[model samples]
Target: MPQSIHFISIGGSAMHNLALALHQQGYTVTGSDETIYEPSRTRLEKQNLLPAQTGWFPEKIHTGLDAVIAGMHARKDNPELIKALELGLPIYSYPEFIYQLSRQKQRVVIAGSHGKTTIVAMILHVLKHYNREFDFWVGDPIEEFDTTVRLSSTAPLIIIEGDEYASSPIDSRPKFLAFQPHIALISGIAWDHINLYPTWDEYVDQFESLAEAMPKAGILIFDESDDMLDVIGQKERDDITKIPYLAHPSEIVKGETFLITKQGKRVSTKLFGQHNMKNIAGAITVCDRIGITEDMFYEAIPTFTGVSKRLEKIAESTDRTVFRDFAHSPAKVEATTEAVKQQYPDKKLLAVVELQSIDNTNKSFLDKYKETTDAADQVAIFIHPGSADSGEQITTSDIQKAFQKPSLHVFTDSAALQNYLLQERDASHIFLFMSSETFGGLDLSNLAPKLI
Candidate 1:
């Protein structure tokens, strides 16, 4: 364990959690972020870990620090980063430091464009169920755990949610590349991060690179359903153990989802969706290899409602339910929308979305979402056309033409969309808000009550 560490941008969700985890492990943890937000600010303050002041102070980066963990939000030329570089201090990007900590442990890295968080969360949920000792790093908050990152000396394994996004400002490599795992699971690969991985082939090449990074004897578990993953799984690799899994056979009866195991055992769960079933299969395979039994996996999974924002239920009435999900990417959007509609075939489905990232709004990426909206009965897209916005040129006609949904509603202002939805609340329906961004800055949690 690192005795003393300084975080360049601690206010970030994962970064703050890692800092808190290290602090709990008896390490000296200090962090600096120009601006800190709600949960991060409050959590850090609770632990007395909040910095005396905000912003970078090069003087704070001294020789006594054991190392520096840089967050993605931090710049290449941050004053503290510059000072750390000047002092010849060992600087590790967020992912790099996580890798360093778990190098000796059996590293299980779940990597893909989508479903990574769910798969990782499922694995962790099961591991904890049977009292199996392990540390984990997941991207989103889970109800099973207080923090997203955990480190313990007694744990013999570590599970990581491997993201393909760039590690940090100075580190150009993808974050997942840092975690050379003993067990690697690629849930599914879809072309994403158009701004960074400009071409379809280039986007896929990142997954191939991840496969190449694994040790010869390492076990690679992948989604056989994915064409790209199928190709990767079939490619010659005599030394590595390759395992392929598809969606667990299941049936949805009366709004309930049940997973049918290989032995024909029906496992009931609160989770819904074919994609979630596939995520379960991927997680089950990973856990099975790590010595968890089919029964144990089944027993633990039903307890996991879901990770935060992945098809999470925010508010509900007798007939209407409102859900908010972190699904900005095309694949995620299609799966989440389809899942909700599948679960409630009799109910009216309204899928609201906000394309937050620049990559999500790119014209080249528009084709990816062509058929995604077709799953919903109605589609409402909210894009704030302002100074920092992407897809400013995109119009309702373009979206209508692309999605083939002539009734698609496009709103540049959140207020108008809110008003429209509030007015339309007389109908009992399942309102699904799907976005990596908040619905044009509308407080959906607060609004959900009124809609109900």
Candidate 2:
């Protein structure tokens, strides 16, 4: 008999993907969410896993369920959670369950404040390129992978994008703490998730704890360019193997990015930017530890166009191109904006950002974004209109002063922001829309109808 699994909040991106993965693995999956959004709703309905009704029902949480996968979206006092507890059903946070599922496999955890998703995608791409059988759980959707999370009894290794965020509302430990990886990589550390970890030192300590979680004789690989990571990587650990990597040697030729191998061989890639190169270097080091050759890596990596929304080209013409990225944090915003500017030095780059998270409007957080967007020829900031009443008073003057770009544009209305983008659009410009949300319900499909 297939195991019965109930999900408390299946509408979340990761939660829905995990539910789908378990269903594909032959489990009887059932879930409830207060609300379900597009893509996740459609995907769940397609699998016949969507609940007949929205919202929770304690009656559904019976003793018949083998386990309950709790998502962060549910409150601590959720009735379903209380029912599951009273019924004595095993309840596992998404990360806790993932750790249990892949406990037997050689876990490779890619962790850092930034670039973890991209690094995981690159590793998965190279492994798929070689036709290697493996399981993975990444935060974003990959090109060829049907789902963001996958598990199979046959696969011997599991590659996980180790987020440092809290596992669940009830569970305060960072998600990576549960992985206990056999091989671990930390890209870099910059303070983020201020709502959870209020101070930078507290956030950095999470990475430190993750580093300590590694089993003796485990392999630790890290980015040497980051001072904090360098200090962490260099710390003496007699039982572990340490490998440090820097950005792969590369040069731009005629507007195309290429990797310069130590053997003097040049390999071209569809993905550009220094941050991406650094991600590839970390992936290659992991591949090397697992017995993949340089020839295989170079041959396979060129075909990797990168995962969706990591500088994804939404629309393009002879002169102008529109891109979308999930870069809400200060470091990511800078890296993504710089990448576009460096790639098309001759073209004008317009960077549009949406401050959806409350942290984005925090006065102290604003200081981190001071000069991050300076690379763009012009910059625009949009605050979600619905959030205007939330009392996070971030004004146009606040944005202009924070960015220190006197000419910066700011908007609180979605329609006004869309019109502004259209007005600023030109044949010689590359439009980059960067946000973790959909720019507060601004439909990109209908954006710039003339340009597309």
lDDT of 2: 0.87
Q: lDDT, candidate 2, residue 165? A: 82
Write down the lDDT of every candidate, Cα atoms only.
0.87, 0.87
Off by over 4 Å in 2: 386-392
Deviation in Å, model 2, residue 207 alpha carbon: 0.6
Please give the RMSD of candidate 2 to the true structure.
1.9
lDDT of 2 by residue, 1-452 (tens): 22899999999999999999998899999999999998999999999988899999999899899999889999989999999999989888899999999988989999998788888888888888778889999988887888999899889999999888888867878898878899999998888688878898898899888777778999999999999889888898879898999998898998899999999899999788888889889989998877788889999988888878898988887778889999988888999999999999998888998877877777668878889999998888988654532465677777787889765888888889888888887633889989998877889878845444
Backbone N/Cα/C clashes per model: 0, 0
